[model samples]
Target: MTLLPDLVSRAAGRHAQRDAVVMGSRRLSYAALEQASNRLARSLIAHGVRRGDRVALWLPKSPEAVVALYGVMKAGAAYVPVDPGAPPARMAWIARNCEVAGLVTCADRIARVDEAFAGRPPMRALWVTDDAADAPRVAGLPTVTWPALAAESAERPAVPAVDADLAYVLYTSGSTGDPKGVMLSHRNALAFVEWAGDTFGVTSEDRLANHAPFHFDLSTFDLFAAARAGAALYPVPPRLFAFPAAVAKSWCEQRLTVWYATPSTLVLFLTRGGLASLDLSALRVLLFAGEVFPVKYLRELMRLAPHARFANLYGPTETNVCTWYDVKGIPADDAPLPIGVPCCNDEALVLDESLKPVPGGGAGELWVRGATVMQGYWGDPGRTALALQSIEVAPGISDRAYRTGDIVRRRADGDLEFLGRRDHQVKTRGYRVELGEIETTLHRHPAVDEAVVVAIPDEEITNRLKAVVVTRPGAAVSEADLRQHCAATLPRYMVPEAIEFRAALPRTSSGKVDRRALQELSS
Candidate 1:
């Protein structure tokens, strides 16, 4: 398939009456999904959203959100998924940065939308997915209710797009106190999706669980792979994420055949979700990524779900699932797992700082080159150039590769073992965060003079953030006060877990904040 929407069209032709998306009491058939998305695409075109434009989806995980994703693609525009739980200011910054042509949201978020736009909406039109009557009108913004959107023709709109065209833009935390957009094309996503579908043997009989949010790259596998195999997709409700018991109950009730999520989530289920008491015999394939899985927890999970085959997927958002390892068994001791060999027609190189290939059994930065690699950071050529470089694979030949900041070492068996990151970027709760971004936010507070954020290693969630602060003289700021300030401009995951007031921060020889010293103290 050249375009992403083709997956849905192909499935609709074969499985017209089959369930495509399922939530609580709601089921949308493949045929219905195709028709609904076609109508939504037509509506977007009528509202001046042209090809190559960007449309933002600002709602939570729901059936409508799924439809909106395909509709944006069908409209020949790239979709930008905004985190529903992000603060208004952060959401506004994303919308402004992407310069979205249209926005899809619900009525309950209208107030927050108003706060984000501040009476000056940037988009050309707004599409309300539910409860339109309760939505308040915003000045200078044309709102389209569901009834109006549904009235459009269900026939597919005539638009031209190619496999190399931009499909979606995912915003990730930037080291400069802003978010950076990663540009991914239809080809980039399909490279990984096709491989995953074939490797996992997904079929119409399989039921896949979409546990990650749409903004995350993991969701691409959940959505496209299911469509490719004509399988049923179950988007676990966002509300159930906080309650591990509810998530476990849903897993048993749904009888999910394929499950893909971060190790942090699985750890939560293993500890508090009551996994031992549940029956997961239907689970055939279980995949984990985003962070290293604690061997102790993984071993216990393997014992509980013996019927499922486990795999470790590793890569950054720029290169989706470059390398993976199938878990046959864990060692008796607490040894770090290998990320495995490259997949999806990708090439892996362990290169030193000078871009020379590292010798066997040596550690170096991981670099990936393949169709799965992203186009680059949207509208930021400098940062893009820094991450993506043209490496000389041979004496007279060079290939473009993305330099992953992660360090890995080649084992004797040819499997690559993952080490820590070379930079300050860390993953917590399956979300990538730049430590400098949190420190920048803290520095903005009037009560903080000097601040440094450190990542404390934890087996459960990968890492927990702790902020060491040297407050300004005469300023009486509490931890709660600083946390509340961060909540206004950053996501919850970016907020520091612990805050300590110090008289002065330790400094290194170069007069830089001593992060290592702070981390030792926090740990």
Candidate 2:
């Protein structure tokens, strides 16, 4: 298929009556999904959503959300997914930054949506996917309810788009205190989806677990790969994450054949999900990514599900899964696992500060060149230029590649061993976060004079964030107050796990904040 919607169209023809998406006993057949998405697309088009316009999805993960995303793309517009649980201010900032022409949200979030767009140029349209009868209408905005949306024509829209056209934009934390949107085209997503479907040998008989949130890149594989292979997709409920046992039960009940999620979630399952007592023989392929998988926990998981094969997928949002490693046997030790070779028709290069390839066995930043790399950061040319640069692939031959900013060392066996990040960016619970972003938020508090955010290494979640702050003289701010302040503007995951008030932040002789010392203190 040349475009993303083509996946759904082909699947509908091939597996018309087969289950496509399943959420809490609600199952949508391939034909039904196609028709629903087509109707939604027509609704969007009728509301003035034109080709190339940006549409934002701010709903929780549900069948309606899935339909909304496909419908947005079918309307010849790229869908920007906003974290449904994020603060209204943050979501509004993203909406404004991308200049979204339309939004798809639920009744519960309409108030916050109004708050977000209060004084800004109103969106062209707002779609409420559920509880429309009780949803309060906002002034000066055209709102469509589920009933009205469903009444639209089910025939596919005739809007023209190409494989290179934008498909989606995912926002990631930025060092400058604002989230940046990573633009991916249909070809970019198809490259990775095609690879994942082939690598795992997904088929209509396969039941894939969609554990990652739609906003996360990992969900791309879960969503598109299933559609590509005509497999059934089961979206794990977000609330089940707090109860690992419930998560395990859900997988067992679904008889999922393929499972993909972050290491932190797997660790939770291993420790408390009661996997030892469950029947997981149906799970055939297991994939983990977004952070280093502690070898101990992974090894235990391997023991628990001996029939399943596990692979570690690695890449930044800029390049969706550039490399991956298959666990052939039980890990020998607690040493970090290699990220393995490049996948999805991608090339990986270990380069030094000068952009020259690093000699074998030496550590350097990882650079990737391939079809799967993102188009660019949405609306930010300077940052895009800095991330995507022309680097030498061969003698007198240079190609555009994304600088991953992740440090790695080539193993003696040719595999790339992941070292760590080259910057203050860190992964916590599979979410990429910039320490400077949190520090900037902390500084915004009137009582804070100086603030720094440090990551403390943890085996379970990769790293736990801790905030150290120096208050302005006589300014009384408790840790809870600072945390509440952060919660107002940041996602729950980005909020510092622990906050400390100090008389003064330790500084280096050169007058810079001693981050290293702060990390040591936090640890």
Candidate 3:
């Protein structure tokens, strides 16, 4: 009953005549969306996708992307939505790592898809939703166009799935140079969906503005919560993401009742997006996550959108939004906004190194326990075991808990206030970035001998990555050359904002690269 497709099926039946998805000039009714997905589901089944098989989606945010999502789930396959903007090398790694059964994308992206799958194990099929006329051919792989894929009957497939079955596998940056898939089950997604639907009082009348990319965990709430409440999902187009003013205009034109994005996105709108001039009388709930919102920009947003209720959500991809804070009012510019309390069916615990609860509300690592915690990292049991530890909650009573590497302190009001990270992982514009991954990419360039990536927090760039590189003796390379090398392998956000060349890296007594000393150099 708690399966992911169940949510879609129920919403389509209940709101059959209502708008289910709105993208630019296109609007899809629930019945139409359901039937289209059913056809796609049948297509996936005919193409040999089975229960638990990974179906990768490397498409942009559109009605077709939404259809592919539900269709793959309806076929009892776990959907893996890769950022369409991902580098070919990264995409290839994910495709091989997951052994994806099929990929749903457009004709325009076929060349990149071919490049990603060039030397890897073959993916079964490629389903192009837009066109197939100019689509590049990949050896031994059949290309199915939209019209041909829809030739299959629109009858629902009887794929066996349950609450425990995986709904999606989202790959995040790994410290070990590659990406790791965080396996989330239907039950895991439902925990946040149900909680968010109730918490925000969402209904069919409300329209949701989805700003986060499909691959991001934040988009989970935007997609599922809307379906849970039988509401309409309005996606922010990829190009509009860059032009903050256009984003503000779209928000007003769409009359979005609920808006959710990273704090940086919100800041962009307030500072330069013409948000002050917009007629946003329809906006209600405004939610932010992925990175800490500076109190200054937050206050300005509050002042402008005084009618909207603001909230802050906190969690890692391993746990989908365990805690949330509904802003009561604007606090002082210097005050820290707490991550707040646990969501429904979830518990947040502050623990020390020994796994015991932290004493006297002191700073400690945050551990999440409950339904929202992920099943585990896909195909990496050793790392999974390290992250998911068993903690005795009540003497003999124990539960599986995710050790979030965030340092936080429980406040006098019983809310958890985030202090900082315990590791090199930092959030850049709401995207979780592993500094080690950037360092690994820098090492790929033939010029450098040693590299260390550090986060330099700023008011404008948020948490930008700064790379300190030591080139091999007599191997000359400019900062631009190194940047181009990183750009070829990494996503735009993961690329270092600034690079510093040095004769040699600072070291500690143990003869290891001293990141702390390097931090001082950056400051």
Candidate 4:
């Protein structure tokens, strides 16, 4: 279990003929997946991808995304998955920042991406996916269609020389900015998959449903962990999430034995009237991560599927997943339970300003240590050093610990309760944000002279962050217009709650926008 390729090999040997992935009519067994990845690995190497090189994958959530991911790792190159649906500018930013050597994308999406990174980060080659009788989008830089490359490459791949190198860099939406690439090493990803499989008791008989996007780290649990168990990974289309009741019944019909999704996804199931009639009798395990699971929803879920085991997982994209809380049932008080503690070889502790562990029930910053931590931001050493630090919190253990920047308190029972982020950063709808990023985006608005965005704790949705701005000398600025501007540039979530106009924004002696004063004025 030292690497991801080992997991694929072991599972193939154990369950060579079992259905590993089921997407509509598309079926791939463990043996087929391993063999395809091996061929793809060879194909990658034949095209000049060496060990530790960055291979970018910009594709839809199909068998190709899954195979290409394993293939990049098998070729000993770090895979960087850019959401095929992401705005071209963001994708370009990620490619340039990560310095990707090659790009694997569909013919349809080739032009935009090519145009984005054109004249910027010099990409060596483009591997275009040929779905049918499709042409090779040959209008760009050195291009080789996927079918041709695979046909020319040897089916058996040469073992690459790599150990503890990066597996993939997952770029997640920033609450305030574009997106940050969470640099995950092979060890970091493998740690999470191994722990998730063991903790959830995944077996060959288990059928897990994958609803999250391929770009999100949560999808790792569904695809890799389930594949490792020789279990069927049922790919749920984005459309099904929109109509959750139909989807839930479909899962029950498929006899899905395991399920994992963000809290919002499952809440949609209940809200859309799907859970009441569905026989989730086949579902034995249920895991919700990403955002906070409402206690009422958890209780309802337990009531609907009494025999199913429930687990709440928590972690940022930088760290795959460090902590989990097992829900036997809801607490009588109905407050969302603590995220529990670290899993497997991972460790967690609350530290004060000086990095000393706080006493039980004392509040402090949550710092995580072990194999689960990421390598840090790709290519940005300043941000990396600020996040990943070395602190001796426990006896005889001193490694580069990642300060989660999340304020937490150790309960008398020894579990840590998440008390929100230490800064203006917030997690709304399962996406992380930095207030400064939103403010920066807002400042770009033509009329916006000064902007300060803050996360206002909301009762309805965990917290709705609102932005307040000062118009430039009687400039005609409407909240609606600014919101529309955000929609065009930023993702929908990153859009401000409101854009309030003020005579003059509160400023510090140094002439910086004082967020504290803005909060006071708004209150």
Candidate 5:
């Protein structure tokens, strides 16, 4: 019923000449990539990865990384990717929680991976790289290496059934707790890819930039969409994101035709290079999502890439892309563009707290109903029930939907306009901040006693990741120093925008952050 593997199979079978994935200095045609994935899939099955098994892929963005992703799925297992750059703790967390049958990583990653999962009984890892074959150059988890076992792998198994079988176990932070898995089925994934390809005018000629981590669900489209459209997907290095000018330079050099990433990233490129410095002449489309995009920056980008189409893409990991806004021209007013119309096979509803639909122009929580909705969260029945289920729909129908937690309003044009989240939780670009996550990080600073992170809207950075962290008496660390400390522990996106020492945080009768009160004061 789903065509994910077959789509790749067909691309090889029929469109073999098309380019599948492109990285610096290497080009993989669909036919060749398909053969590589097939061989890898056979190796996985030979290693005992059965249908519906979980295969954790912890590697950087490279041709091999792409091979492992499709290979795992081709072998009929869910491919769960953990960013190679993640700290040992975060890597172990995702691995243990997802209960991966095995992991595929490079030798550079072996030491940290072994250190984290050393005690976990069910997990094993495989490494690739270096004169790996010479003199046991590979060590640590001597038992864990994929290439060594490939020869032992006897045969490739048949593709698994599409019905109720998982295609991926993409992990996203749990709304109320630690990270949890969102089970996206073959049907769930294929529906989105198919819909996105057609809806966004994605074609074989389109060349997209992949900026999101392989672990993040957004990259699912970036990776698979390339195969789906027979287009080339260029995975940018983390360094380019930091030095966006270099990225802009590469855009000109590579002739990148389409861009899909978070708004924060685009703003950096525009701010760093300005539109005039970069040669974006070949760029025809700019699709952005994962956070609120500022109107000023978008308008500037439109002017810069005058020929490129600007699109507002909105969705969550649980619901693969529910809506889109095609930037036909600058909106007459400046209130950031609406999240736009729902995609084919998708429906959006803005509902009040009681689950009643909000009237036009009234703000409420957004709920998505569609074929693209995920099966459920992995392992947690309580949360799975909360996120995936019936929500203000025909009482008798058996279909389910997802509650996005984002608040928005239906505009007069029938498009959805952006509002903030229903809670203190805020998103920076594509990453979700639990507010509590940052506060917990602040509490770790030796000089800090307690802290509260608040989201303040700004045109450039979008959400002001400001922290009102309380310091102990005579503590040495300052605001800027605290940011450096955070950079060591967390990714740059998670670092607090501004750190302010406080005597005590305000609180409501419930003694929460008194978030509303803090907002009023900040305003």
Candidate 6:
């Protein structure tokens, strides 16, 4: 299927009576989901949402959220997913940045939406999943209830989207400023989905768990792969994420055969989630990505789930998934598993600063070129061009490739071993963050003179962000006060878990901040 909506339509035709999505006690059949999305699509068109328009989806993970995703695509619009747990300011910034034409959310969250808009949102219309008499109504913008939309004609709308059309826009942290949207086309997403399906041999009998949030790229495989194979997609409740025992019980209860999530999440289950003793007999495939799986955790997990096949999938959000490594039994305590070979239709090259290939397994920046590369950052051509560059692969042979900004060493066997990033960027709890961004936000505080942020590795949490700030002479600021300041302007994940106030910061010979000194302090 070229367009993403076609996946849903074709699945509905084949698995009409089969369950397409399961959330808690609610189950939506393929036919029912298709009809629901069709009605919602018609309502969107009625409310002046034209093709190529952007629609924002802000809601807790639920069956209706899934329906709205497909509905937005069916209307020939790209859906922008906003994390419901995001601060009001972050939400507002994302909606404003994307210039969303409308919003799809629930009644309970209308207050947050209003707070985000600050009484004057740019959206032209709003669709509340549940519209009760008590639901707050905004002035000027037309409001449509879920029931009202469901009452509209269920006939499929003729949206005419092609493979080249934008499918979705996922926002990630930016090094220069706030978050930037990564624009992905239908072709980019389908390339990864088709590869995952064929690689894993997914079938209708498989039951997959949607562990990642809709805003995360990992959810793309869990959602589309299941649909492509006519399999059941089970949406794991967000609340159960903290309680490992409950998460394990839910996995067993749902009889999930395929699982995908961050390595930190899997480690949480094994340590605190009581997954080691649980009966996961039906689980056949286990996939982890987004961060480096600690060697100790990887060995322990392999011992616990010997019956399951484990694989490490690695890539940045800019490129869906470039390389994958399937675990071959258990490894030594010091051995880190390679990131493995490139997926179908993809290639990974270790190139130097001049875009020349590194020889004899030397460490260099990892660059990738493939159908899975995103089209570009939305509305930011300059930044897109910088990230996407043309590099010569052979004598006078060149291809446009994404500069991954990661350093890795190639093994003799053609496997790639990940080292670290080329910049201050780090992956903490499956989310990519720019240390300079946090320091920039910290510098905004009046009492702060200089600040440096570093990623501190922890046993339990993969990595924790720590900030060391040097206050202006005689200016006093408590950690609590600085944390509150950050919490107000930044997302919860971006906030520093630990803060230190120092009288002065160490500097290098050239007067630049000595980040290595700060690292030693954290250590």
lDDT comparison, 1 vs 2, better candidate: 1
Task: Give the residue spans of candidate 2 off by over 4 A.
Answer: 119-121
Task: Write candidate 1's Cα lDDT for 192-245 as tens digits.
Answer: 999999999999999999999999999999999999989999998888878888
| Model 5, CA-based lDDT | 0.75
lDDT of the candidates, in the order given? 0.92, 0.91, 0.88, 0.78, 0.75, 0.87
TM-score of 6: 0.97
Candidate order by decreasing lDDT:
1, 2, 3, 6, 4, 5
Q: Kindly report which residue pairs in candidate 2 clash with one another.
A: none
Instruction: Flag regions of model 3 displaced more than 4 Å.
Output: 119-121
- Residue 218: error of model 1 in Å? 0.9
lDDT of 4 by residue, 1-523 (tens): 3677767777889998998888767898888888878877877787788888888888777777777788888888888887665667767777887888788887788667656766454567777666534543434467767666547444546665544688888876554465677888777887888888998889999999988777778888897888778888998754565577778888988999989887777877887746888888899999888877888877888998888899889887877788888887788888878999888577887899988888768889988888778888887677789889998865996788888878999888877798876776776766666777788888888999888887765433455778888889869979999987776556567788777877877889999878787777665
Off by over 4 Å in 5: 125-131, 134-156, 175-177, 395-398, 441-449, 471-492, 509-511, 516-523
Stretches off by above 4 angstroms in model 6 are: none
TM-score of each: 0.98, 0.98, 0.98, 0.91, 0.90, 0.97
After superposing candidate 4 on the true structure, give the runs of residues whose Cα lies further than 4 Å from its correct spot: 119-121, 132-140, 173-178, 456-461, 474-481, 497-500, 506-523
Q: Where does candidate 1 stray beyond 4 Å?
A: none
* Clash pairs detected, candidate 1: none
Q: Model 6, range 207-299, lDDT digits (tens) per residue?
A: 999989899999999989998888899988877766878977899877899999998788888888878778888898999999888888888
Two-way TM-score contest, 4 vs 6, winner: 6
Residue 455 accuracy (lDDT) in model 6? 89
Backbone atom clashes (below 3 Å) for every candidate: 0, 0, 0, 2, 2, 1
lDDT of 5 by residue, 449-477 (tens): 87777787766656767888778888877
Q: How close is candidate 1 to the true structure, as a TM-score?
A: 0.98
After the best TM-score superposition of candidate 3, give how far the Cα of residue 154 lies from its true spot, in angstroms.
1.3
What lDDT does candidate 5 reach at residue 296?
82
Summarize candidate 3's per-residue lDDT along 1-523 as a digit string, tens digits. 6776777788888999888898888999888888889999998888899999999898888899999999999999999999888887777778778889998988888888777666453578888988677667776788888888658887788887888999999999899888899999999999888998899899989999988999999898888888887899998887777888998899898899998899988888988888988888999999998888888888888888898899999999999899999998766556868999999599999999998899888999999999999999989999899999999987788999999999999988888999998988988888899999999989888888999998887775578789999999889999999998998878889999899998888999999999999888897
